[model samples]
Target: MTFDRKDKDNVTLLNFYLQLLYPRMVEEKMLILLRQGRIGKWFSGIGQEAIAVGSTMAMKSEEYILPMHRNLGVFTSRNVPLTRLMAQWQGKLSGFTKGRDRSFHFGTQEHKIIGMISHLGPQMALADGIALGDLIASKEKATLVFTGEGATSEGDFHEAINVAAVWNLPVIFLIENNGYGLSTPVNEQYKCKNLVDRAIGYGIEGLQVDGNNILAVYDLIDSVATRMRENPRPVLIECLTFRMRGHEEASGTKYVPHELLEEWAKKDPILNFEQYLLEQDILTPDAVAEIKANLKMEIEQEVEAAFNEPEPLAKEEEELKDMYFPYTSDPVSPEGPVKELRYLDAISDGLRIAMQKHTNLVLMGQDIAEYGGAFKITEGFVQEFGKARVRNTPICESAIVGAGLGLSINGFKAVVEMQFADFVSCGFNQIVNNLAKTHYRWGEKADVVVRMPTGAGTGAGPFHSQSNEAWFTKTPGLKVVYPAFPADAKGLLLAAIEDPNPVMYFEHKYLYRSLTGPVPEGFYTMEIGKANVLRQGQQLCIITYGLGVHWALDYLDENPDISATLVDLRSLQPWDKETVSAAVKNTGRALILHEDTLSCGFGAELAAWISEHCFKYLDAPVMRCASSDTAIPMNKALEDGFLAKSRLKHTLNQLLAY
Candidate 1:
């Protein structure tokens, strides 16, 4: 159906006088700042204030709004103070981000406005996450995600919208089709006449509105917001308007036709709205002038205060650093707690206890809440902790994991679960960019735990079964851990939760049900980078971790004549090289074993380390025993036949032979 209704005099203005005049004056002030060199650059919401103001006005307080960078009008209208915003552009500590974010990266968390992701479409995913949060929290509020038509072409936008549609999330996607995405025209970017029609592919309805008319934008978006609360679905709305300014400063906008530019110049949003108000008799020229005068005075004062305000100070920076790190370090714990508990229970109880101890700690994965996770490791948390603390997230791995880093950086201790380790590739970006590098780049820690059910042997086949610890152990600043029994699981998890860095804490799915061991009921601690000397002997040092420790210890027990020191490298990075080095130095002979494939496995690295540092002390060349680089077969016997366990058995016999 053709939605060609364009009612010029129909736009409504409902801002408290302070809020109303503030936006127009701020936009003008920004223009002045750009000319005065007080700010870096400016992107004005000059001709689009109607859409920005009205749509934001239509939203509920609890409802989320993910505004595009151009929504300066909406920001001002919704209580994003002008002085702080000016400081944001000025790169001052008085900025809304306290001097961290970019100039346009404005946010008003108190107003339920999530910060925008500037690369265009990342905010789509964030908006979906906000909706997911609403659903999980059982809040009736919906999410309003704003973007330009240019963002519609981004792959992430499609991915986010598709997922939202499939899940029937309470989300409204608003596209400010302001004729251009900088130099590129909206029509040039996509073949479609309307950006909203793209939602049809994802099984969601689309609507188009005359963005120049504020009432059209307001009433349409408001109805969509209401529909979301009632039916809980994702919808896309295209707002057709013209952008009056160059994309960011006065640069690279030479592409628009002179005729079109002149035509748009005649239809400026504020002036047209003023004329419409005059015609409706709702406002007079004198009243408008008075409003502008009051706004100008208020803005002048706020901007002066913002510019004159002192820096956030060392203490505030220190506090922001802590906000970015959910976990608290324990003076590098004096003792590793491996001796006190079993493996599986170690991780489960460690996480449980950490959640109890840290109010900011939140957990999520498939069936993790009520089911205590698929392994029953987190089984009782829902009852004891409530869904808010221990929640079951939808099976959207990428979206779920991506938010973990963002949430953790924003003061929540997030533990995102990839139900099976093999499926981690689905959320690889979250693990790599969001978690590992975010800390090292900005000198801020993203204290998030990515828990995955790893390893094999339940006949789950290649898809469900994997021992891929080696792949991630290679990444710097990402602490990796795997536990064999209940105690180590709990201990290592406790250490992981408290680490001021990202941790890839993997639990063996096979061992979760059967690997129970005694864990003390009381809360305890463990050192993250230290490994335990499970069994010490004089002949050789066998460095291993995860369930491999179990088989090695058992083998040593049976053959006391084959004396060896077993070291569990609990933390993969900053691994207890001291412990391993000492054991190798004393024993003279060394061997490294693991469950992952032979090629470049963690065992290979250990062997390389021994060869480099302990070559002189070695009784023989360092050896590595690992599984073949083939998919774990469905047949149990064949899988075991191809495993590192058999090679480990052979190595033991050979060491004895020597």
Candidate 2:
């Protein structure tokens, strides 16, 4: 099956032709199905079959191939059952995503194919993650990822390429320059003469090939991949091709010039390759006709079989089942001796302990290696564990987060640290769209823990200081953990890393050095979704988390006769509802407090829930005290005034009096 010219015979060439022909015919049948309302939509790759077929066939089966919507040949070349593919396109139960996603949006773990998200550039970074796994495992395998010329304009493209170049990961970034991105031409896409030229800027090798020529693609990819297995490094390859069809069947090609269509139609990949096969006597005219007939018949039968397949049943339990992997909370034993540590030290120790426990755990972030991160959390980590385990990524938040998802796909627990919580905005799409939606979309576990250094009491300004926990708490498949004490910080972090779902561990920057407590010496895991009752009282309940817990404790310490119960919610996403409700009912009054802004904060949800469930037991209305709906100020006095702590005593006294 190797593409060696000296070993090439009629059989090899015929097999190549069959590989190319199957997708072309599938595209043809799929179009008819789309027109006949059999399927939802189509992203036709009519004129660019050679790129997908040749590049995919060039790699080994164990090496992963990440393909976009137009790269259907990647699936077909891997011999994915046509019936299942058709069922996928038709949104049937037998599809890879079980009707959760349509078209080539689903990936098959068995085939070692990672599918693309709609944001085309993220998958490129995802490939870097898989290649990183290969590099770490010392596996001689190269990961091939496909992108369009249009996606090259995305920041993720540059970020992924730059990271791969720096790490020397075995990844082949294949850009199929199909003349147009949807309707925008190459002129609008970039200023470079060729897409491959950008590789020089990244300090990586670049190559260009006629995408229509199947042999050229096969030869170049095979040689590059072979070299990469020995000396692992990324290479950029731009395959010059044209899109014969519109972006999708719904979008007509009227925007395209007729002359251009005619020109590309003459150089159709299938026809040109067929002619080459005919001239070489590898495929006679009768053989070509017979191959097409058989492929068309096979495709039609598969499509018909797909039509007979059952549609996904609208069952509530089944629909909700795969949102997250099954998890049980392990009791915190704290088996060994304990030692006092700061919040920062507890986080450091927790990560250190997790790294020791899970050999496959990887830490990725900016300035985390030699510099020990912005907060000095991972100061000596690179020295303890090598650079491979403690990776210092570029300031490409989007790409690095996507890489975490990639690493998780290959059975690695990834802990991605956001230097500051506010910086997460840069990688929002990867977090919410890719990581959070992964398990729900295809039942794939994303064992990634994103450490967000959050909160603002030291005048770090609006950008550096933000308690944005509510942003991800609303996201379905993500877990949000925010601990106030040092011990809880370490325990919750350990639990977050072990969780099967993507967990957002928000570490309060204000608490890093200011807070200290007795943290267990050895490894231990605290139960997520549980609240800690720091104090018990009968008059009122103070519900809070992170720095707010400190604020509540300070208020309670000064006012001894207040008789208020303090509840610190360790996890926000699955906040301890039972404990909060019970405390509120017991006290007959409630006050929700947080460091985040007042409007639409996590406090709002807590207030609403308390009102709904604890209405009968309430002695007073549920009150919320939070920061003003404005950006965190830089001046110390203004910041103190802006925070909820400024008015916490007054608010608590008012609630107690009520």
Candidate 3:
């Protein structure tokens, strides 16, 4: 693995020459496939081989890589079979994602290379989490992540590097500055002389190298790898190269100036490396020709074999329901010693119990370690579980979510906390795009729990106080749960932690202390996507979740005249539609309520469902009562007006009258 001066130049030449051949051959074959209409679209990394090949060669075998679309060289150099790569391009079942994805969006768990999504920036942030996990576990291997110049323009780039720098994570931000962000030129991307200079802002070492020179890249990486083995600091490396072809085959070279293409063609990495081997007397003309011929034949054979491989069989709609979510069944209610605990205490207890039972569970959040989180939910966790398990991260929401995905990929369940549910927007892409879709796309479960401290009863203004569960409820391939009672908080969270898919656990901020109840003592998990009946009546059905359930209960308690059944929808995404429907039909009237703004809240969906399914059974139209469509104000009066329990009472009275 050592590429030192002691090694013969001929040895290095042969190694580099072969590394360059695979991607170039693949690129050529992809172009052929594109013409024949065998593949959907093709992205050629024709000139950018040196960066992936050299850097991968310098790293250890066990190290993980989060590659972008233009990193076929990385896949090739890291021993990914050519047949599998070709099969992936053809969207066959033999592919890593089993025809779930096309193009470069496929990777295998065995290889430790996560499949790249179209959003290039989140993977870079994800690499930070992978590196952090290894670091905490005291692993020596470092993570190398590839990103383009355009991706650096994203906030994820800054958030990722900032976390790496602050935490001294063992991750390398390898920026392939290929002189353009797709059609846009590098001149318009940023004003900085070199992309590496931006690394100084994050207080990390920055280096720019001739990306065409494999030896230079290898040496710099080798040195950095040695230093990082001891120091564990992030490094920003800008590989100055050019995209020899159009962005993709269909994109064409039309937008690219003829002069620029002509200039870059002369500096082609593979051709240049081949010439260097010949000039150094390391490879004869016949040897070079033979190698090229052998590679061409091998690639052609693999591509042909991949084409013959059967495509993935189409799954039935019912069978595909739990492909991403397996645990759709009801929960087994707990029967054990009961402890009267606050909702927050119950949550902490759940975490403590889960971690104590499962060694693989790790808790991460901003100010969660010593500061014990913003709401002190994890006040004593760091001392009990140690800092490595109860990790304190930088204020990067995206990185936290992205890192959780990485951890889940590596066989660890991460319990990541968002300071406030409203702040989840910062990591929205990672949550909705990466984490939510991973299971559905590749049958890869992202076993992560996002503990959201949500709801608007607190006067923490628009940023800190908000109910955003409805946002994730609309998303596919995600488990959304909002526990009302302390027992449900403890039980549902325990279930979420053990679940194979990504679960969004929304803990109402107001309910943390106010909604105290007798929580079970031992570890138990309530069924997800199931509703609980707090009180049963016949005249009307009030269906609600989170704090809304309590508001509905209060209205009935004070009135005593309202004969309404109270149903708490603990799980929103895969809601208890059957249970709620039965209750609505039995009562002959339905009311959906929540704390999120009324316009597009979970109430809308519930109301729609009741109206459609129980139209004939109902005595009156399905009605909804939720906060007004406006930001929660800091003033107590305005905040109360925005989400007052009296509103629920008035709305229920009108529904009864109707």
Q: Which one is best on TM-score?
A: 2
TM-score of 2: 0.98
lDDT of 1 by residue, 1-658 (tens): 1222244333334242234346767878778877888777777777777677778878986566778878876676677777777777666776655665665564455766665645666667667656765665567877888888888887667767876886678888888889988888866899977777787898999899878666566778878888789788999888888887788877745887889878876766566656656666767889888878877888889888777876555575564444334444563332433344535566766777788888777787888987777677787888888876676765667666655654554456678888899888877765665566554333445667889788877888898888888778877558787766576677677777777678888888777666666665656556777788988889988898877887788778787788888898877765888899999999988888888888988888888888899889977778778888899887899889767888887886675456
Residue range 533-599, candidate 3, lDDT tens digits? 8888988998988888888877788889878889998999789989998898889988888888889
Residue 357 alpha-carbon offset, candidate 3, angstroms:
2.1
| Per-candidate total of colliding backbone pairs | 18, 0, 1
Candidate 3: which pairs clash?
331-527
Question: Model 3 compared with the native: what TM-score?
Answer: 0.95
- Candidate 2, residues 73-170, lDDT tens digits: the string is 99999999999998887788888888888878877789999998898899998899999998998999999999999999999999999999999999
